[model samples]
Target: MKGIILTSHGTYASGLYQTVKMIAGDFPNIKIVEFHEGDNLENFDQKLIEAYNDLTYKDIVVITDLAGGTPFNRSVMSLADKGNVAFLSGANFAMVYQALSSEIEDLSEFVADVLEKGKSSITKFDMEEDDEESLEDGI
Candidate 1:
C-alpha cells in the first residue's frame, strides 16, 4: 500500500485532511503534519519523521502547501535517499482527494497523475460574465 503525508505551514494540512475525510470518509495510511507559527526546522523534521515512521506502507507520497516553503524543503531533505518516498508540493484539495482514492501501484505514475489533476483543477471563474453571456445566448 502507498501512504500520503500532507504538510503545510499553517493549519492547511489538517484542514485539508478533514475536508478529505468529510468527502471520502476515514482512510488509513494518510497523515497530516501541520507547521505552526513557533515551529522551526527541527520541529518540522521531527514531525515528518514521526509521520513517516507511523506509516505502514513502503511507498509514501508527501504533499506540501508551497513549492519552496519550509514544509516542502524539510520534506525534501528528510526524504532524501529514501527511494520509496516521493514529494509533491503546491498541494490542493483535488490532489489530496485523487491521491487518497488512487489505486495506482507505480509511484511515479501516481504522482504524475495527481500533479496533472491538481494543475487542471485550478480555474479562473468569471461568474457574472459567464451568466450574462449565457443569458444573452438564450440558453
Candidate 2:
C-alpha cells in the first residue's frame, strides 16, 4: 500500500484531512501535518519526519499546499532522499481525495491520473441567459 502525507501552513492540512475523512471515511495510509502559527521550523520538520517514519508503506507521496513554502521545502529536504516518494504542491480536495482512496497497480500512473483529474476538476460556470431570465421572473 502507498502512503500519503499532507502538510500545510496553519490548519489547512488538518482541514483537508477532515474533509477527506468526511468524504471517504478513515484511511490507514494517510497522515497530515499542520504547520501552525508560531511553530518552530525545526519542530515542524521533526513532526514531518515522524509522520514519514510512521508510515511503513512501500511508496509515499508528500503533498503540500504551496510549492515554495516551508512545508514543501522542509518536506523535500527531509523526505527527498527516501526512495519511492513523490511530491506534489497546490493540493486540493480532488487530488488528495483520489490519492487516498485509490488502489491502482502503478503508483506513477495513479499519481499522474490523480494530478490530471485534479487539474480538470477546476472549472468555470456561467449562467445562461434563459436561466438568468427565469431567476429574474421567479420561475
Candidate 3:
C-alpha cells in the first residue's frame, strides 16, 4: 500500500512533532517523521535519503514544510532518480491530512489530489460568518 511521511525541522520536544499529525489520526499507512539537526540546505539530501529508507512504504509521499528549503529541494531532486515516490514541498496540515485520508493510485494523480484538497479547504472567510454576507463576499 502507499503511505505518507511528514518531515519538519526536528524539535527537541515531541510536542512540536505532535502538532502536525494527519487529521485522520495515526495509522500504519500514514506516519510522520522528523529530522532534527543537520537538516539545513547543506545536507538535506543525505538526511532525507536516510529517512526515506527507514520508512515502510513502497509508494510514498513526503511532505515538507517549505519549497526552496533544504528538505524540499532535496526531496525533489531525490525523486528525479527514483521512480516510486512523490514529494510535495510547502506542506501544511491540510495537505498531509488529505494525503493520509485517501487510498493510493498513480503518484501523479495522488499529488494532484493533495494539491486540490489543500487549496479547496482554505475558506477566505470565517466559518461562523453570516451566510448572507458570504455570498456577496466574492468567491
Write candidate 1's Cα lDDT for 1-139 as tens digits: 5799999988998998898888778889888998888887787898898898898887999999998898888999988667899999988989998888889999889999999999999987688656656656631
TM-score of every candidate = 0.87, 0.87, 0.68
Tens digit of per-residue lDDT, candidate 2, span 8-102? 98999889889888867888988889888799989988988899999988889898999999999999988899877889998999998888877
Q: Which wins on TM-score, candidate 1 or candidate 3?
A: 1
For each predicted model, how many residue pairs clash, with residues at least 3 apart or on different chains?
0, 0, 0
Candidate 3: residue 99 Cα off by (Å): 0.9
Each candidate: RMSD: 4.3, 4.4, 5.6
- Where does model 1 exceed 4 Å of error? 128-139
TM-score of 2: 0.87
Candidate 2, lDDT over the whole model: 0.86
Model 3 pairs whose backbones collide: none
CA lDDT of each prediction against the hidden true structure: 0.87, 0.86, 0.64
